[model samples]
Every structure is written in structure tokens, then in C-alpha cells.
Target: MNRTELRFALHLIGFLDSVEGFEDGMVKLRDRRWLVWHPDVMAALFRHDRDLRHPPSRTLSPLLGNRSVLWLDGEEHAKYRRTLAPMLRGTRYQALIDEMVERSIAELPSGPVGLAEWTRRLTLRITGRILFGVDDEELLAAFTRWLDRRLGSRVRTLAHRYLTPGTTRFDPELDRMLLHRAETAEPPALAAFLPPEDLRDQVVSLLFAGHETTASATAWTVYWIDRTPGLAQDLLGDADLLEATIRESLRLSPPATLAGNRMSADGMVITPSIYLAHRRAATYDHPHTFDPTRSPPPPGAFFPFGGGVRHCLGKDLALTEIRTIVTALLRHRRIHLNTQRSCTPQLRGAAMAPPPSLAMVATCRR
Candidate 1:
């Protein structure tokens, strides 16, 4: 395995071996130190530890900015998250469901396509319209091109340098496009609260987080549903089953496999392994199986979205989007896996993405 995969495997092995107790270890990988923790320790750290803070990764800080909510801590983080919370509530997102469904239906391919790429494009479009109030195809295309390079790049340092806020400027035209949208837009609920200087970074961060995670989750949802015979038909008639399917897919393949690493002001590091936590046998019966009919896992027990104060602000909106996309796709088309190989999750940057080669055929439902 390559260095990144090796690090992930070590952490996973530690988690699997310590399913009954807390697991903590320090590892030096690529010249940086990481303190990884399983759920037992994570529960305490997430709840009572006020000092644990998300230290910006060398790669992410330049892209997300110092002021973005993901990098903020304590009062600043809470304040920023609170401002953005209203836009993600169920009532607000419910109003957008029809539009989301319509868009997915229009964009879905009628023949074999890479499911991951298709979902990423659809989610990016939905995020662009909802968050920025800009539906210009060319602008969205540019943003997708820029974002894909950053996310998919293998040259870590170069990608970090390219995205770092002041080291090198973003494309002038794209900057103007985003700034113009921010100046003229409404909704996304948090836009009004962002200062002019911080607006671009915050918007970029939101767009990245908003589309990337949902794309991974939605892609996995499609894979699992297609793998299970009769699953689509059952979901078509049952709302609970559909919701359960989404949850099960998330449980097995959370997009954000690892929560952001948090470090105390002193010297301690704490990172929560969301992937390991989801697989805890105590919390999930047949932890690895994708069984949608099983009872829902309990709160805190299932956290595809990290927990406590830093919980994802877009959690509700993400769920709504995933449900809408999956429902619309299944309802409008008969999907079948086109590849002979079984699909599995692989790390793509910070998210757990389905195999890049995963292909599926979608036939329109008559």
C-alpha cells in the first residue's frame, strides 16, 4: 500500500483490535505526528474537552481560510455555525426538494456512466444554486474544474500551495464571479453575516464540503441499493425504508471517514475515526453488512457527521439532498451495476469515495 493507505490501515487496525476499549496511538507519517483515537476516547473528547480544537491541516487551511467555520473554535466556531444553521433546517430545505428532484432527473444519464462523477456534478449544481444563487453553467463548470483539480490531485504540497489564500491568487475571473454572486445573493442564511474579506474562502469551503460529502454518500447509496435485489422497489413504496437505506449506506461508508484532527493548546492531538466508530459491533449489529431493514442505530452511536459543537452545519440539508437524489433517481430510472467487480470505498482526499471506476446503467422508467 502507498503511504496514505498505510496510515489509514494502521488506524483501522488499531480501532478493530480495541472495539471494547479506548484506543490511542501516536504515529509519525510523512513527517507529521497524528494522535488517533477510537470512539471510546472520542466520546469524552467530543463532550467535555473544551480545549480540543481543529488544527488546520497544511493542505486545508490554505483552501478553507483561517476564518472559515471549519477552522474556527469555541465562540467563533459556534457563532459562525449558528448563523448558517437556519438555512439547513428541514422546513427551508423542504421547499427546495422539488427543484433538487427536477434537476437530478434532468441530469441523470440514460446509459452507462460513472456514478460517482455523475452524482458529484449533480450535487455541485444543486449546491451552487442553493448556496450562491448562481446557476450559470459556465461558472459552475469552472468551479467544478478548479475544485476537481484540488480534490483529486496526488501532489499534496503543490495542491496546498495553489489553494492557500494569499500564496497565489485564485483565477481573477472566477474570483469576480464568486464575489459578484456574494454581493448580489440571498439565502445560504450565513452570507449576510460574512465579512467581505472572508466571503470567498467561506463560500469555497461550503461549496467543497457541501458537494463533495453528499456526492460520496449518494454514490454509495446507489451502489448499495443496486446490489440488493428488490431494494429499489421496497424503497419506492416505503419512506422509512428509503431513509433507513440512506442511513445504512452512510453507516457503512461515511464520506468523511475521519473527523478533522483536533489539537489542544498544549501538545495533545485528538482525531476521531468516524469509520471505525460506525463499525463498532456494540453499536451496530452485523456492523459491516448493508441491511436497511434493521433498526436505526442510536444517536451519537451513528455519526457520519461528527458530533458535539463541531457537528456539520449542513447535516440536515445534506440528508435532504441525498434523499431527494436517491429517491428521484430510483423513481425515474431502473439502475443496474455495469461492472463485474464489487465496489468498495477508497480514500479521496479527506472523504471516502466509491471506486473511481464504478459504472452503472440507468434506464428511464416508463
Candidate 2:
């Protein structure tokens, strides 16, 4: 079969996603892991993925290597996930969607502005309100600045080499707590969850990865849906169709372009390529095309949040946030791409971001 055409067809059918699919793809990049069976192998990869600590594997998805659990495998991964479980349940996250997100988006400045940058703001606000219970505007801006510095600089790459295990670095938590506690009182402060150094990293990862990544996915989805007039009509015409559109969009531009990485210390056939498998299952059609009106595949076909035990911890939160924001946008405002729009990819550490210049505008309902 002609793989290229097949890739194109999948996009036409909405089977493969472009933005994030490349992140998980094996055909192009080197040193990556993709979950094929998803419900099976992706789970297996995450379950045994901790081998990174031993060496050879070093770090999987080095772009997101700082996440604490990325180095843990098997029972260890489970233990950490268990502790984090209560905080990220689907239902609890869904609750935050309704009460907090709408008001925040409603407050944005209107008229031909770049929604790409704003999408990041929208993700951060929901995460701040729901998880940290703090929304100090200035502190949030500071953390965003620090995060941008860390991700968009070469010093971090140097730290990966020079700052091994014992070397100290400025704590990532100091800013968020200051931002939250300094501003609000209702849920009180998070004087408790701040200590365990490693837990702090998780919070940082949650903010950076949680909101930024989801916002990228959400922004692209909104843009493409608007580009495809028929698909936008489909979503506006049917609620069930909304979920399908989101699923297809996620398949196209995944937040993390790459999936998990694995190494085998034992006799295990540890094939380090989750992104490839993700691209494989969704193979066919212009894999890069952004077509929302596609057919749904069987479970585990598109491995974005990953597969198995090592799946993303904040997936439910991200989904709730995206759905809430998208659904809300669809409900009130009509979004249109400005004809003179321009955006360039900015490198932020391991993440890829559209330049800060990326801009769009939406109209408020009458």
C-alpha cells in the first residue's frame, strides 16, 4: 500500500491527526516510543517505562523529562499515580469546568485578537482555580515568565548535564503558591502540598504541561473547525458531534508531539517507539490534514494521552478544560480566523510554541 496516500486518506477520514501525531510518529524522528495496542502495549510501556533511571534509556521524551514519575516504572508509577488520583478525578475536574472557566473566557478582550495565546491563559486560569485555588493575576504572569524562560533557554539543557541529582536549582513551586495564597482565601492556601520538593515539580509540570499543551490543542481545534464550515455546522447542530470533533482534532495536533520512551534492561523486547505506533494506527490519508468530520476508530487506536498504566495523569483535567472552553466558545461567541494572521513556531525548551505574535479575534453574542 502507498503509505503516503494512506496517510492522506486518514486525514480526509479524520483518522490521523497532524499537530500531535508527528510528536508520536516514528517514520520521521529518531529515539521515540509509540503505543500501538494502546490498551495493551502503551500500558506495557508505561508500566515498565521506569527503566530510564537505570541508564541507556536515560530519559523518555527528554522534552518532558523533568516530570518525576517519568523515571518510575511498574509499582512505582502506580504508587505516585494513586496519590495523585483523588485530585484529578473526571467528575471533580468537570465541576471546575462549569463554575470557573466560562467567566474567565467571557472576560477576555474581544475583536480580532490571537486566540492562540489566550488559549494558554484560559487553560492556566482553570488549573489555578481548580487545583491551587489561587488566581493572583500578577503572580500567574510571573510563573508564566519563569516557565517560558526555563523552557525557552539553553541553560536548562546545561542543567540536564551539570546539575545531576544533588545540585540545587531554584524551586519551581515558590511562584505558584505565592501567586495563589497571596491572592485568595476561600479554599485557603496550599501551605501543605508545597513541601515534598518532588511534588512541587508535579505542580509545575501540571501548570506548564496541563494548561499550555491543552491550549495548543484547543486553539488548533477551534481554528480548524472554523476553517471547515461544514464541520463547525455539524458541531453546532449536534452535541454528540462535538466530542467526535474534539477527538479528531486531538488526533491531529497533540500537545506533546512525542510519546513515551522506553529501554529494556531485561530480555524484554523494549521497542522505544510509542509515537510511531500512534501514527501507525491512524495511518492513511494526509496525516497532516485537519479534517474534523471523520469516523471514530476502535478504542486505543489513537494514542495521544498514551496507553496503559503510564497514561497522562492530568488527562481528565485537560479534556474537561478543553471541552468546557470549546463548548463555551461555541455556545456564546462566533470565532473566525483573521485573513492577515501570521504565526511562527517558537522553541520553548522541549516544547514547540507558536510565536507570541499569534493573534485572532472572536465576536460576543448580542
Candidate 3:
């Protein structure tokens, strides 16, 4: 549990514009510096893992988000990012997660359901089927446990599984599958587009990034829509607004608040201007309210995906997942707030994995 005062301090960052201030309503927090003091900064902190020296340490472990790509950095990060870049950035790979999402949505028969878990299951299923091509009951369970943190993924326990013969060779098996898929698939296929090892890393990257952020963002969008009336009507009326809602929700309640950090190792007298970007009234109208209908956020107004060279590599996948889920949601149901459940969310893992109760009662349409 995060400190209540700390959480309040973090939430205040996103509301900086609410404070009367400079033209943009942004406040200067320090010398020659303006800050927005955004709420989502807390989410960013959850995303960035700066210490690479220790591969599997108490503080920084490669989020094996069902085998994530977060562990690699520097040259490894660049290489992995490049190989998989086109798969999502272009039209061909856009539908990769879409197909999986459609199948997952098919499971939601016309009735009331747990919107948070439904969203999580869709995201997890997409990661499983489309991204990593992983299919292991125990590994999936372990992955969920690892994510939920009711149980931890211990080095010794993970090692024991690998050591035991006939146990799932989760990573290696996927590597071989990627290689074979590349060998057999057409020349322009995604598998063929990436080198063998890079293909493996890319899959892991997609699995981690593809699901987690989208899941959180989707939760926020749902929660926000449920809580805000006019905003919900606007979103439901225009399917197109769904994307805007995602972006605004991200601005209001960022997916990973701390990812914008620039460390000294980044080799510069670095300065961060995230707070200014978020809180500046010039950048957004009524910047503090969770209203999506306000003048759309400014160009490069938010960096939920971070900025500069190490900006989020899986941004496309995450956006695609959010758009797909939100669009489907607008078409099929009306989401109402579950006032009875607690609205508080925890920063799970290295991102804002909202606790599975955002109080979205899904009412089926026709």
C-alpha cells in the first residue's frame, strides 16, 4: 500500500493547473522550472526500472510479464525495439491483437459481468495467443500470481520448475517456435521480419507491454466514463471519441506515471518537464477535471508512453488494445459506476495495474 500522504502528493501533480498560476496555469516548482505535478507521475514511477546491474534483485527484476522484454536495455533494447517496430507501427500488424481481442469479447455473453476482470482476461489472452504464442496452464497461473502478488515469483521456485524434467520450457520453447514460424511463414510475415533472438525478445516485449498498460488504461477509461456523466454520453455517442478518451484518461490517470525519468547514466545534465506539460492550462482546458470533452490535449501534451530515445516501444500495441476494447465496449454496453465497491487502485508491479474493482457495471445493449 502506498502512503496516503504520498498518494495525495502524487495525485496533486495532475491537478497543478487547477492552481491559479502562469498563463498555462502551470506553477513553477523550482528555479527556472515549471511543473504540472501530474497525478499520473506515480504511475510512471511504477514503470521505470533503472537498475540493470542486478538482473534479478529485490528492487528490480525483469517483469516476466508472462515473459516481458523490460529486462533488456541499451543496445539490447534498441535492437529488440527496431525488429518489432514495423509489426505494430504499420497496418499489417495492427490487427494482430485485434483478432485475439475479438475472440475474447466473444466470451462475454449478453449479461452483467466483472468489467475489470473481463478487461484483464482479454489483455492476458491477447498476450498469450497473439504475442508470445504461449500456452501453458501452470505458466499462465504463475504469471497471474506473479502479477496479482498474492504469490511472488521466487528465483528458487522458478529455477526448480525449469530444473525438473518435462516441466515447461517457457522461454526456450517460444524461441524455437518463433524460429520455426519464421522459417515457414511467408517472407514478409512478422516472424521473417525479425532475427531469431530479436523475434523472441520482441514477443516477450509485446506480452508485457501489450497487455499491462492497456489493461490499466482500459480500467481508467471505464472508471472515468462511469464516474463522469456527460463524458460517458459523448463517448457512447461517438465511437471515435474512444481514442480521445484513452488519451485523456492517460493524461488524467497515466498508465505508468514514472517512466519519464531521465537518469544520469542517460549521459546529460538532464532536466524533466513532465509536470509543465501536464498542468499547463494552455495545453489543456480545465486540465484538472477528468473531463474528456475538454479541448483535446495539446500536441505531445502527454507522455504516457514517455519521451526521447527510450520511449515506449510497444506503444502501438497498447493503443490498439485500448482502442479495440473501448470501441467494443461502446458498441455493446453501457458502463455504470459500481458505487458500492472501493474505487482505490494500487500500483501493481511496475505500472498502474488498477485493482480489479473500478466499479463498472456493464449493462448489455439489446
RMSD to truth, every model? 4.0, 7.2, 8.2
Please state the error at residue 182 of candidate 2 in Å.
11
What 10-residue stretch in candidate 2 is worst by lDDT?
8-17
Evaluate model 3: give its TM-score.
Answer: 0.65
- The 0-to-1 C-alpha lDDT of every candidate, in the order given, reads 0.72, 0.56, 0.54
Q: Count clashing residue pairs per candidate.
A: 0, 36, 16
Instruction: Please name the candidate that would achieve the greatest TM-score relative to the true structure.
Output: 1
* lDDT (tens digit, per residue) of candidate 1 on 76-183: 777777777775664575656668667667766667788888888888877777777757778778887766666564354344544353553356787778777867
Better of 1 and 2 by TM-score: 1
RMSD of 1: 4.0
What tens digits encode model 3's per-residue C-alpha lDDT throughout 146-261? 44542122333334323452333244544554445435544434465565545554554455566667787887787777766677667665756776677778877676644432
Q: Could you tell me every candidate's TM-score relative to the true structure?
A: 0.85, 0.72, 0.65
Ranking the candidates on TM-score from highest down gives 1, 2, 3
For lDDT, the strongest prediction is 1
- Per-residue lDDT for 204 in model 3? 45
